[model samples]
Target: MLHGGSLPHLTPEETLAPILSALESVLGSARPVALHQPHFAGREWDYVKDCLDTGWVSSVGAYVTRLETALQDYTGVAHALAVVNGTAALHVCCLLAGVIAGDEVLLPTLTFVATANAVSYCGATPHLVDVSPVTLGVDAIRLAAYLEDIAELRGDTCYNRTTGHPLRALIVMHTFGHPAELDALAELCRRYRIVLIEDAAEALGSFYRDQHVGQWGLLSAVSFNGNKIVTTGGGGAVLTNDAALAQRARHLTTTAKQPHPWAFVHDQVAYNYRLPNLNAALGCAQLEQLPDFVSRKRALAQRYQHAFAAVAAGHIVNEPQDTRSNYWLNVLQLHPAYGHLRDALLETCQARGILVRPAWELMHRLPMYRDCPRMDMSTAEHLERHLVCLPSSVDTGSVDTGSEHA
Candidate 1:
């Protein structure tokens, strides 16, 4: 629908013209291109069928253990616990990081709401921070400066000068599978005496400086949602290098049941967040093909970069230096001068079945988090206005619409 036809009731601005043309060139004019979709070209059917045939579709099964082991190996984390969803994994991470009531957790304002919600679940305040334009994640330098000004380091704990709440942890979310500046952020956290946690929900195949993204944090969360590069039909995983933390995560996520074969012995109150065998069966198959999926996704991102190279209004957001990204969802960041055209572009693209979308609203802007402690949000606000996510499914057939670049 967005191929060569003119948009009705539109001013036909030069900026919008090239963007639409690029979308048409990459995604064709026949059908809608979803922003992100799961591709199950691996052994999903075989593994899932095996689970079905064996009647091990519940939480306790061989597939669940296999999936966890595979994740541990893939991410290079000593422990990987498969959970019900990404949010659940984050919640567990927050708990493990010792985020208690009245504590404050540093979070990127540009991330999804789930990151903030997870902290809230731990009874901690989500102290919002700004993100870097280069990585679209927490700006380590800016945050360091902000912390130097407002953070009080007494003993080994970091406290907010204004709120007087202990800064328990810093959650760095890898936006669109692009790894954040983990080394710098880790150094900053160490100086401030704050824990480092990673919201790696979108960074399954991403690596920072040859090291996987989740390895830098004390604990990290990864998602396998339907729209993610890897999907477990709504599942997630918690990764940690500490064996003690891993053991606690396993017990907590499994309802804290002490090992007893014949008796229903229960320990402390915990959650039933274990991943079902049905979901892990799918996850195992998906994990096996992660390398292929990341390759195809990177290829798709290259295509988008080439298609939009000549567009003066914006350019595709590339992976940061020294990082290998999965390019989970390719981003088109409009130039500051062309920021006003973002809405028009989104509306036009969606109307024409291109399925483009803007980034999520900043966490500080949301009503529930309006009163949360926050620093200057100028960077995130600008990014929110200029960012647009393009269709980035791994299936290249849907995007190979011919070389009709604008």
Candidate 2:
């Protein structure tokens, strides 16, 4: 018996066997291997079939409305606007937040590229700040320092000299389904008159205090991509408590047209960013299952944590405890003191057929973001080399047990 030891990291053979078994049992031996299979059943199928049958499979339909309604209920936000994807949702939020060209949007560098890309879409500069190693989210003290430095250098209350622009907004990304420092970020935004937009793409069921992730910001976004916890295959939504901002986002996403019968008059430039009814139907079904999915994912995470507790000493990583997370992707950060051993461990996991992946290269270090203003991301750089994402799925099936090192 392994006793307090974590279970062995998965081998490719081990990972494939269960998926193959499920497929053989459900779809027969004809199906090929798949990394992920949608777990839709019950009302999900009903929704998909009904959508096809009604010929309301395109962008506009009752299903879209239902998705919006369900999202509002699930997140407790006053309004929700479904969009084609998370990027579109963030773009629309930046537009509504008045993030114009030459303005700077403060954001953490340790997030998906899209989080920073959306700022570029509006022609605004992204000021990528370093993150706290503990939370893997933006550092509040560092942010304040950046703001103060800019204010002093520019002799302006709002503009930063390094970026050569006024910091117009703050885009807070909830990294890996864990809620960021929202309460502190919110207060900072308010004090600076900076618009706050939460990138809750990875944090659907995650919460800060008692409120859900999407409900914290003035404008917030969520993604339902194929790899996400609750996927609509490809869809996203923006949530807001401000009635006017919600109305404006909806208007802009649907082509910014004035209501005219057959007039086809467009008032301003807009985007073809509305979610298709078919996708929305899928979203609605997924939303219905989110609670169950969250519960199962958390349970799986607890198992991983228990396993890791044994091996995580000088070189293993573990989860944070300040806030509850949706556990979208279970991460293990190798101790930096492990040095070259981090790469060796990653190679070992892969050699054993486990699909462990490194943290995204710090966005500021990426070729596209190199020119963007960035504070020295010492912590992000340290974590980047060692953090690994395990093959986490709510449908772990018989492979429910796994080892993790803290």
Report how far off residue 199 is in candidate 1 (Å): 0.3
Mark the 10 consecutive residues where model 2 has the least summed lDDT: 397-406
| Model 1 spans > 4 angstroms off | 1-12, 396-406
All candidates' TM-scores?
0.95, 0.86
Q: Report the number of backbone clashes for model 2.
A: 4
Q: Write the per-residue lDDT of candidate 1 for residues 36-113, one digit (tens) a residue.
A: 767777788899999999999999999999999999888888899999999999999999999999999999999999
Question: How close is each model in CA RMSD to the real structure?
Answer: 4.9, 6.5
Candidate no. 2 TM-score: 0.86
Candidate 2 stretches greater than 4 Å from native: 1-37, 152-157, 313-322, 397-406
Q: In TM-score terms, which candidate is top? A: 1
Residue 257 in model 2: lDDT: 78
For this target, which candidate reaches the highest lDDT against the unseen true structure? Answer: 1
Model 1 TM: 0.95
| Local distance difference test, each candidate | 0.90, 0.75
